[model samples]
Structures are given as C-alpha cells and as structure tokens.
Target: MFTLSEPLASVIARLKAPAQQGQIGRLRRGIEKEGLRVDPAGRIAQTPHPHALGSKLTHPHVTTDYSEALLEYITPVYCKPHDALAFLGDLHRFSYHYLGEELIWPASMPARLNGNASVPIADYGSSNIGTMKHVYRKGLDVRYGRIMQAIAGVHYNVSLPDDLWPLLREIDPQASDTAASSDADYRSSRYFGLIRHFRRNSWLLMYLFGASPAIDRSFLDGKPAPDWLEAHGSDTLLSPYATTLRMSGLGYQNKVQEQLKICFNSLSNYVGTLRHAISTPWPPYQALGVNQGDTWQQLNANILQIENEYYSDIRPKRVTRHNETPSQALEARGVEYIEVRCLDLNPLLPLGVDAAQMYFLDTFLMWCLLSDSPWIPDDECDHLDDNRRLVVERGRDPAMRLNIGGELRSVPERGHEIFTELEAVAELLDILEEGSPHSDAVRGLAPLLDDPSLTPSGRVMARLKETQQSFAEVMLALAREQAEQFRREPMDAAHRALLDELIETSHRQQGEIEAGDEERFGAFLEGYFTRAREPRAARAV
Candidate 1:
C-alpha cells in the first residue's frame, strides 16, 4: 500500500478536528454539460438552436457552445452534488419539449458529418457582445475548422468553502510570505497549488471516467486513421486500450497550443502567459486576415483571440462582471473556483455524469487540495502532458506504465497509491454526512483500477464488440432511448415554471441589449481587446 506524504498526513490530522472538518461540508459545485443536437437519423442537425430554449446569448441556463447544434446546459451552484445534478436533469427535460425531432447527441465525439461545412457556427445576435462572440467562433472556424467545434464534453466547476482557506493556510507551513500577503493571494495560491497537483494526477481521472474509446468513421472526414487506431466495425475506428480518444490528438488537442507553457504556479504568471498569447500575432492566422471588406473574417491575428482560446484540462476562474474578461475577473478579485474541463460525456449515462461519479470527483478534488503539491518546472509540465496522452491513447492496457515523480510505475500500482490518499480525504469530507458516501464512492471506483472492464471506456468497447454495431449506430440508439426516458419523466413543477419565465425574460433581455447598442462593431471590438490588454494589477486597483 502507498503511504501518505508527511505534509498530507499532517493536514489530514489537523482536519480531523470537528471545527476544521465542518468546513468541508460547505463545498459548492456546479456543472456545464455540452451535447450536440442530432436528427432522428443520427446526423448532425442542420437547424438553429430552438427558439423555445431561450436566447443563446442571454439565457442563464441553456446556451449554444461552438455550434448552433451544440447545446450547453448550465446548472446553478449547489452545496450537494445531487442538487446540482437534479437541476441539470430538469434543464434536459425542459429542453426536450422544444427539441422537436432532434435528440441530444449522447457522446463526446460528433455524430455523422459531411466535412467541416456541416457544423454551423453559433450566431449569438447583432449586439456588440454577441457579435464579438460570433466573430470569435468564426475565427475558430478559420483556424481549426468547424468539425472540431462539434465535439462536446462536460465542465465541472467547484469552489471550496470560504472557511476552509484559513485552515489551509494554517496547515501548510511552506505557503510562503507571498501567499501570506492577503487572504485573496493565499486562496489564489492554494487554488493554483490544487491545479498543479490536479494536472499531475489527472490521468487517473481519464482511466476512471473517460468514455470515448471509439468514434464513427465519419468523424475522420475522409482522413486516414493512424496505424495505432485499429478498425473496429466498418464504420468505426478505435484504440483497443484507449480511454478518451476525445482527449487525444484527434479531438480538441491543438498543435499551436502545445508550445504554450501557461504557468499555474501563481495567478499573476497565469494571467501573464495568457495575455502574451492573445497579444502575440501568429503568421498562419495573420495570413487569414482579420477582415474582408465589411465582413469580419476572424477576431484578431493573435495567437489566441482571447484568453478562453488557450484551452487546458483545468482553469482558475472567477465570475466576470459586465464587459469584463475572464482574466480581469480573476485579477480584480481572485480565483473563485476551478473548472475541470477534461471530463468526457459518458453516452451510457443520461446526464453524461452520475452521483457516484460526482462523489468521486468531490473526493478527488479535495485530495488534490489537501495533498503536498510542488510547483511544476518546465520539464515536469511536459512530462505531465506525456503521461496524460499515454493514458488517453492506451490507459486500460494492463501492461501500461506511467511516470510517477520521475519513476516508471504500473497503472494499477500508481492508482492504488493515489486511492490510498483519496480514501483519507474522503473520510474527512464524509464527516457529519450520512453513511460515509464520499468514502464509499472512493472505494466503489477503486475496483476499476484493477479491473479495466468496469471502466466506461472498457464497457463501451466491450458493447461495440458484442453487438457488432458501428459507433454511430450504437450512440444513436442510446440517444433515442435517453430522449424517450427524458420525455416520460415529469420535471419539477417549480423548475418548470422558472424555466418558462426565464425563456421569455431571456428573449426580452437579448432584444434590449441589441437595441441599446450605440457603438459600432469595430469600435466595440477595439475597446474589448484594449481592456483585456490593460495591466491586471491596474484593473485590480
């Protein structure tokens, strides 16, 4: 069995006190899940985002992601995982009423495609902010193509209790004077520490929850598959031991972003790196031109149009105010929460995620926070990425070995070591809670470490082999099944009423914003980027 580090053990011991343990109960979490809209025939839907779903630009809950067909569901923060999930379910049920004949695509990989043109970019309306949103997406289409924009996934947002910060500061002796400068600084630093540890250990999450092991051949768009991806059925390409091909090079992974070294060691470094990327021009993008006559071809010729373009498995976030950028919010205040961006949508699960998985996530995130995390050096960051790619491509392989702190360790061995620590964290979280649910969740998923077949990816591959169905065919059937189930279920009366009100209100709000816009699009665009480029410290002042 793996033993906990002295720092982790010491913190766990301190957290065992009733007062410190009570703070754990105050954790808040939310979910933002995205799914593509496909027709009954399982092809990408050509229709616009349904009108009854409310304004994609103004709706607080439902919105379009990269494409009009990619529906994103946002849940309000809830203290309990089940409450958040309940809200997400209500959102799904509410959406189905307006969906007509379209079904929410159940998988992370896109449904059948007819090249890049089939995926329509989302149009947020003519308001300056909405126009900027649309143009940024248009830039994405020019740079990466619309096909990649259709891929969907879940983003798990979470924040530790406010009361937990002081305790964390007290427990970590090496938190340093920099973190000791202010409460915001200390909390931000600690969150970055959590992010560092998370980045290092995130491969474990891929092994446990990754569900996209196969994709329909249509996703390839006539391109040949790599030698490593073997043919599954006639219409599918798969990696036998791969966990999340969605996270692999084939999906959201970008070649240009590979060169970016965003620092998670501190909030300032993080902001600096992002700002530099957005400010620096890239030749390839510059060649595309920012505009053609009156039409905006792209947002800018920079390496990134905005901070959001530089994607990562995780992000340090603070809620932005009106007309503020994400970085501005973080700098003006501090990291309010961290967003887990790497989770795949399990087609088998109606919500793409489940309660037990939520409990496990809570346990895992808490473990990351309480662990002894050191700053990752340049070489270590590259190593972390390599480990993640290895797991993404061939995680379920029994013979697979991963680099753990510079040593080669078998997947099971390293996983077990991590779980040992996770169990201790789960225990602290489960205090005052009924039935040790968090600890139970950790123990429940522990078996997947030893038994690959129990994993979502493993199960998916197994089903495909047993049924001899194409990836698209299997997912289409599952989508239909899930849609029927949602239709049969009764939505909460209170939630149903609230959604009805919001749909109407959101439409009005979108119109008001558009009508109120006085500045030209060109001027608005310039001002937005100018504010984004201003010194974050100045903005904070």
Candidate 2:
C-alpha cells in the first residue's frame, strides 16, 4: 500500500505562515530593480509578443522522446512510424487534460482556445485531437477561477479484484471507501489498486459516457473550421500518455464485454441527470440569468452535487465560442476514472509549470479525494447540470455558492481548504526534498496565496481590467514575455546537433516505411505493442 504520508496537521500549520524574508525581499528587489511590471497585487506582469497570449505551450508528457518515453511510461509502441498516435506530442493531451470529463461533439465546434501551447491559435476549428487541458498546468497556477472551483470532479465507481468481478457490484460500501465504510471495505485488496490502475491507464479507459450532443456550426462564430476529429481524442491523442499494443490488457483485450456494459450503465445512470442545453431552461440560451426548472441557482443549492454529480476537470468549454460547448458523453462500455474537461494554460510560464505551486494542486486534489467524492445519486445528478455556464460567465463573483456535501458552501471556504491543505503539503515537500531547490520552491506558494493579485490568472484579470483589453490582448502580452524568456534559453548547441543526427536517422526510417518495409515495420509495431500490452513483460525485459 503506497500510503500518502504527508501528515495533514503538520502541513496545515503553514497556511498562515509568511514567506521567508530572504526570498521575498530578493523577489521584490528583483522586480523593483529590473523595473519589471508588477500588477497591483504585486505580481510580475505579462509581456507582449506574436504568440504573446501563449508562451511556449510545451506540456510535459508531450515533450518526451517518443519511443523511449513510451517504453518508459506506457510500454509497447505500435502504429505507423509517423504514427501520430504513438508520439508523445499527442499523448500529452491526456496528461494535459486531467480533469474528469470529456469534450463531446467537437466536430462542428470552432473555438479559440489558448491551451498549454506556445501560441493561442486564433481559431481551432473542429478537431479535438490533443485537446485536453489539465485542471491547471502541471506545476503552475492552474486552479480554475473562483466560480469554476466548485464544480469538482469525482468518481463514484465500485471496484472488483480480478477474481471478484461479476459479484463486485452488489458488494457493500461500508465495505468500500466512500460512505459509511464497512470493515472489509477499506481493507479490500482491490480498493487502491483499482484506483492506481485507473490513474495510470486513465487515458485509455474511456467508458461510453453518454449520447454526444449534436455538433453546432453556430458555435464557430464565422471561423473556418477543420473536419471533425474522433469524439474522445485524448484516448488516442499523441504524447507519451498514449496506448499502444503493449499497453493493451493492462486494460485492453478484455473478453468481459458484459462487465464493460455494466460500467456504461453505471455511468449512464449518472449522466442521465444532465439534459442537453436546448432542452434545459437553466442554460437560458446565452443569457446568464435565473429561471426555474433546475436552474444554476437551484443547482448551487447543493455544491456537492455540482462537484460530484456534474463537474469535470479535463476538456472544459472553449472560451472563444459556444458551438459544441454542451456537455458530452461518448456512447461506450467500460469502467474507468471520470474525465474532467476544463483547464486553460496560463501563457506566461514554461513547461506550463513551477514547483511550489504544484504543492497547492497536490493538496487540492487530495482534498477532492479525501473529502466526499460521491457518485451521482439516482435522484440528484440531472437537476444540477449547467455548471460550465455559471463558471465561464459568473466565476469571479465571491458571493456565489454551489452544491457541496448536499449543501452550498461559500466558494471561498472551498478555496481556503484547498489552499490551506496545499500549504501543508508544501511543508511536507520541503521535508522530502530536503535542501533541494524544490524545497524552497514549495514554500513559495504561500506568497502566491497571500497575494492572489500576483498569480497568472490574477495578473491576466488585472491587465484586462486596467488596459480594458480583450482577453486576446492580455494573452498577447503574456505570450511575448514568455517568448522573450524562452528565446533567450535557446536549445543547447549539443542538443541541436543531436537533433540534426536524429533527423537524418528519422529520414532513413521514413524511407523504409515508404518502401513498404512491412516486415520491418510490422515487426516493430508488433514488438512494441506486445511490450506495451504486457507491462510485466516490459519490466521483465
């Protein structure tokens, strides 16, 4: 059992702790002496550039060496040599979009999203490939803005040991972890392993969520859109997170189609609560207002319902357009982690991450996990559907509340708990990292919380407010600043030369594939898929 040992009490103590003077002063002085533009709340301002809205949007899983990375993480590498699926560039989408839901019917949707990439492509017509954005970027300020936080992602799933499968569902929860646990429930050998396995192979485990909404061209706003992509692109997205033949049966090749069908039914039971935007009066057809019949105000009455029954982390609604913006669940059959689908990368960072901030996220996720993450009870899941509407349009208002624990709690309290727990996690990371740079970095989150005016989101809001610029303007400014910094740190010379060599090798491989070198390519894909499909075999190798 891999216990999460960072004790809660010890870490919580740091919530009120102030930043160390040495680092704080140096940070302040660095900004002051350099005349760096700090926002009203004392954070560096974003600079302007061509892709100024998006600094280099290099996400982690997307940045690894393709074959080596697959070997290291997923195992097995099948598909075409230029197989975009086998590449790490695409797989990062899954890691990027760690939220607990999927983006449905993007085929006719045209959206302008500044994701975890360098430039905010002005118009991303209908392709959903590599479209998932993590709740926040990997190591940075990725938490959703105030209103969005309440819509938490959770999984109300039951698990079974390899042997207990058919009989697992009727099992008791007092025997499981969620509510009123039974003695055998927590100790059940299948519990955490199911979760760990889900977490590890999450991208591949797309259970058919529900009927995807119709694609709406009107969502495009006059932009030229591309052809529609596969509904659940993250499942097949390029990046180190992808699935190859080797990765099969770790989750794939299950002959138990009925077991999978049961999983779909379970998921459908939850999704049933959400009616389409057209059918629901709550969404109010582009008007952010109140009405009856399961309105947001009603939904907010129980924040937990929003968090558990309705919210997601990955593939959030696109900011620029509304077509295909409706919630979607692919029709499939399987059991897996819920997908969260909303996150926009802050354009001003590198790798879209930082160390100290990661502690904030770690604690936040733990809170989501430790607190009551429930399944959509048979009665409540549907009445609380229109969460994204409230978030995108009315998220910043602190007065707003949403359902949680079957009742509404102020969003601030939710934020506090998460942030507070994060500070504590920082303390633990400091201890773990010891004297490493990561230790000092972990403590830096306090400063971020103390001065929310300084975070990337905060800064963007401030800049937009101060300059009275469109979101696009704020984006350009940040992009330029990040680009300037990235440009200065050009690829190392040795790395560039090595890249040149790899390119030549790659060109030769291409020729082999072009010559229909079936034996060679087939051998490679087979070996790779087999190795990937069998994790134990790869590890043994």
Best by lDDT: 1
TM-score of each: 0.98, 0.39
How badly does each model clash, as a count of residue pairs?
Answer: 0, 69
lDDT values of the candidates? 0.90, 0.26
Model 1 residue 404 CA deviation in Å: 1.2
Task: Please give, for residues 376-478, the per-residue lDDT of candidate 2 as tens digits.
Answer: 3323432232222222322333455545446665434444444454444445334423353333443554344334344444454455457754433344455
Pairs with steric clashes in candidate 1: none
Model 1 residue 205 CA deviation in Å: 0.4
Model 2 residue 441 CA deviation in Å: 7.1
lDDT of 1: 0.90
lDDT of 1 by residue, 175-277 (tens): 5756527788778888998999999999999999999999988888898998889898688999999999989999897788777787498888998888888
